[model samples]
Target chain A: MGPALEVKDLCRGFGSRRAIENLGFSLGHGEILGLVGPSGAGKTVTLRILSGILEGTSGTASICGISVASGNRKIYEHFGSVAENHPLPGHLNPFEYLQLRACLKKVRDGRREATCALQACGLLRYGKRYRIGQLSHGHRQLVALADAILGRPSLLLLDGLEPRQLPAVLGELPIRPAVLVSGRNAAEMADFCQKTIFLDRGRVVVDEKREQRN
Target chain B: MFNFFALLTYEWRRISRTSDFFSAGGLFLLLSGLLFLFALLCYVGKPQTVSPFAFWLGHGWPMVLLLVPPLSADSIAGERSAGTLDGLLCASPAAVLLAKFSALLLHYLLLWTVALALQPLALFLASLRLPFPLWSGAELFGALSLLPLSGALYLSCGLFFSTIARTQAQAMAATFVLLFGLLFGPSVLLRFLPACRWPILEDILVRLGAASQNGWPDRFLNFGTVAFYLTATGTILCLSAVFLRSRPFH
Candidate 1:
């Protein structure tokens, strides 16, 4: 009914050094947004704040009209996140890892959901055969991606990942969710995302909307 | 509730996979085995010195001191260092901490259970009439019942250290220090104070020393000690959750 995500006047600082400042943005269902910035542009910090991992120094972030600052457990049910350098347990195979993720997210029928997520990621075979630690870097990213999509959350926040063709994957879902991905490649993300927000030193330098791509 | 159980199971599996788990388990088993052997030798060679079971029971506190920190030192700090804490905080921090604490406590208890399983070997040895009885059923029951009660506080304390420390080594060191302080500080203070002027203080210190030492008098459970451990464990666990939730990434 409302936008899937909203942030207003958000500011986070480590003492006097601000990681993100006066950040404001919104995303609607089925829309894809790109957060493009330099190393210290606050892209990851913005994503982390939205995902409830870090407490913002000031302002509000809400998911599906629920404030992230409320510290409500129910807010987590509305979103799934892939963090920068997502850590996968080396001991668990990909399939088992997904099952564990599904379980943590309180997905009903975790096994079935894990199976479907693996299949959707096109890693069902490989995931079953090998531990996540043994997988290539690219494969691990896919596994993390699969985990984010497991519960069909209303909002998906991915940090430090290239969303080159993530739309292709999100398109197949029964109800496409709002996705905000952070990365360094501005041109590629501009071409890929419906809306691209370029951050510099924790401020939005540019927020552009491309003509809707078919 | 669902989150707690899910996270608990995941935590258990995750901790068991670490090399530290195996190393700690090995150390525990080795120490427990040696204690059993020594007790058996003491019984067969010189029955008048001390009962084999009493000797075994007397040594449990040292094993607990040596084992708990290693098991729990990395429970939270390792996740933060590896950058996994962000992913886990997607769940409630309370659930995550509770699950980690539960898993660590379970692992700690499981280790003691394995070590105590050796008690049977001594029992079997005593059956050959080589010495007096190893341990009475009541004595065994008392030790078994109090093991978790006494050990939970240490594990929770370790988890608190893990939550606050930035690395596994720091957590381990902090836990060992805190445990050592709790274990010996009272006795050290008691020795320095004049007994006539501080009789009440001495009495309280004596109780604390016994409580921290996991002392089992007459092989019976002490309800006051049980209450103290449980309350301290719960308080430390709550503090751990609070620290985890408030932990900022600068």
Candidate 2:
């Protein structure tokens, strides 16, 4: 019943330098929000904190009403994440990699879900044929995207993917989840997102809704 | 439960498939085979002399000392460097650490088994009937019984280093340094520092020495030593899991 994602006064700092300062946002179910920022603007940091990969210095973030900082393994089941510049296991093909993800997510019929995820990414042929390391950079991004969308998670956190890939990704989802994607290209993100939040120097510069843009 | 087993299987598959493992394992087997050949050649002249099997067992620890670091180093540090650690954190760090540790321990045991098998194969090829005194059943039992215990301690230490280090190479180097120090440092210190005439220090040094542990393969049972290995291994594994859970990165 609450927002699918909610962050209030979230702050993350590395010693003296703040990565994100007083960051706050909320997204409802099935709404797609874009997080557009320049490099070092804390977009990735925000996503990492929400995904429970990193701890915040202050404040709170929750996904589907579960606190991200709770250290509860169950929190992971409600959402899926694609980390920026994170590497996939090169020894595994796409199907195998996704199978591992499925196993971690505890998706019933893991093999079938993995196959379907690859098919959704339009990578069924390549996923079967090549190891993830052997794929092109673009394909690897797609594979990472596909990984995030498995299990039909309630919230999806996608970071650092190319803007051009958004259409193919959004078109393939059977039922859209609450998506928060970060990228540098604001114009392209605006096309796919109902709201776009622009960040600079770890502070929100603008929070534009569809009505405001209209 | 499913997550743990799946991770364990994945670690097993990946570790076994590594080309570095194959190449290092091949070199180990080849060198061990040569050592067996030399022992066999030496055996023909004197039936009353030290057995080739005993000699082979004496030299086994140094080979294991070198082999385990490279294997275990790549578990956590390699995952971190490859940037997969974030994705894997979905599972509890304890599960991930346990899975990786089990896979590496199994691989370590397999390599030793293969190396030990060379003894019988060489004997069969030589077709030489040796005197009963040359084969020591007690020594074989001692080595086999203690292998898993010692392997757990060493591999856990290596895994701990991997969890702390930023890169695979750094993990390998740190583990190698720590292992060599733990196994050999006391003996080296005792040899150099004649001023250490205190009885307790002498006893501790002697107990901690590689010469003493290698000598364990000849002795049947040492419960204190077994307890020491198991306790130390468990502590290191716990620390590894803790470090992995509270990973500090910029």
Candidate 3:
């Protein structure tokens, strides 16, 4: 089988500022890769490009061997994304928000999946009554994580989630999905990631397997 | 169809629950009530009897037009500022814009309905002194026709502003400026020009401004005017969707 997600020669720029330059990476099925970089080092930008939220200036990305440029709805259906700020509709409670995501993803057994996802994220009790805006920052992060995992997407893209929240997420992340997470802290990146790719000024500076790093 | 409804429902819930929505709605109600009371006092205080209720109804719809746009100004722009555009871009850009526009249109419709409901209360108060037709069924229907069209026009403009704006405040300000330009700016310009110059310049400006071409007050309901507004709205909405899709979210 092909890699779960493949990005080659990804270049994205905003006017004079280059967000990412020739960023090439691939993830195998069920692999967890940590993207480590400083602020403005293009980690979030790369994740945005891969998740189909942002178009790169040049290069190609394929999800499950299907090119994103071909208008592959299946690719999006199989992928989940969580950005730095975790922007949920502030009016919706956790349960309503997850349920809406499940419907959008066309998940089978949506209610069951949403409930399980929330419970796994330790957010089941706050499920029915709490709006996203009312939730604490850490809890909001968890909600976004739950949204990413609820549909059991084959590929997951996460940015700016702290290490403390990682335990709640990683401990219960669904199987068969290749996960890519980005952070500025190398220590936190090293903790959960099986492989680490360090970036500097929009280019890859380090790529090491966890075992090699150890 | 299910996806469309689901998106619409989600948007409605999101917008209606915002602090901005409540504040705007409350302001509209307060202003309308004050205007009604003022009209009543003026009529009773006058030597010649006038239909205070009819006067209020005449002024009500135009005031609604002024109010609705501000309520919807930030509909899409807020999403962009909050970094939610990335998540929304996961869906088809066309669908997202259409769904948001529908939600805004629905919000204005509800506001219009509330304004319409107040007409009866005004009429009942007027009935104590004189017999007057406060609202004819035909007039009500006519005004309703224009409400959706005008609301769509404002919403399309707002959507375009949201696509280009970097911040919520900027988007809101742009929306107000555009709306004010469309509604009152032409009349203000006409006031400065002489009558001979006004005829030529006013025609051109009104056509360009998306104003009702038929006449003032009653002419607001003409089919051609409604079509013109709707067509403009559709064109702007299409442009906004394309712009949003082209840029994506980064």
Which tens-of-lDDT digit does each residue in A1-214 have in candidate 2?
A: 9999999999999889999999999999999899998899999999989988789999999998899988887887889887776578878889988999899888889898888888888999997799888898888988988888888888989898876776676677787789899999889999888999999989999999988999
Please report the TM-score between candidate 1 and the true structure. Answer: 0.87
Please list the residue runs of candidate 2 whose C-alpha ends up more than 4 Å from where it truly belongs after superposition: A171-174, B36-56, B120-132, B185-219, B222-224
Each candidate's DockQ: 0.53, 0.62, 0.53
Q: Across residues A43-100, which tens digit of lDDT does each residue of candidate 1 receive?
A: 9889888887778999999999999888776776788788776777776788888887
Ranking by DockQ, best first? 2, 3, 1
The CAPRI category of model 3 is medium
Model 1 chain A lDDT-worst window of ten: A163-172
Residue pairs with clashing backbones, model 1: none
Q: For candidate 1, what is the DockQ-based docking class?
A: medium
Q: After superposing the true interface residues, what Cα RMSD does each candidate give?
A: 2.3, 1.7, 1.9
What TM-score applies to chain A of candidate 1?
0.94
Candidate 3 DockQ vs. native = 0.53
Per-residue lDDT over A107-186 for candidate 3, one digit per residue giving the tens place of the 0 to 100 score: 78888999999998899989998888899988898899898887778888889877567666666764757888999889
lDDT of 2 by residue, B1-250 (tens): 7788889988987887666878888898887766666665676667454543345344565776778898899898888877788788888899999999999988988888898877677667767554565467766566576677778888999999999988889899988998788677876877776675686676556545533333434333477667767887989999989998887563
Candidate closest to the true structure, highest lDDT: 2
Question: By descending TM-score, how would the candidates be arranged?
Answer: 2, 1, 3
User: Which pairs of residues collide in candidate 2?
Assistant: none
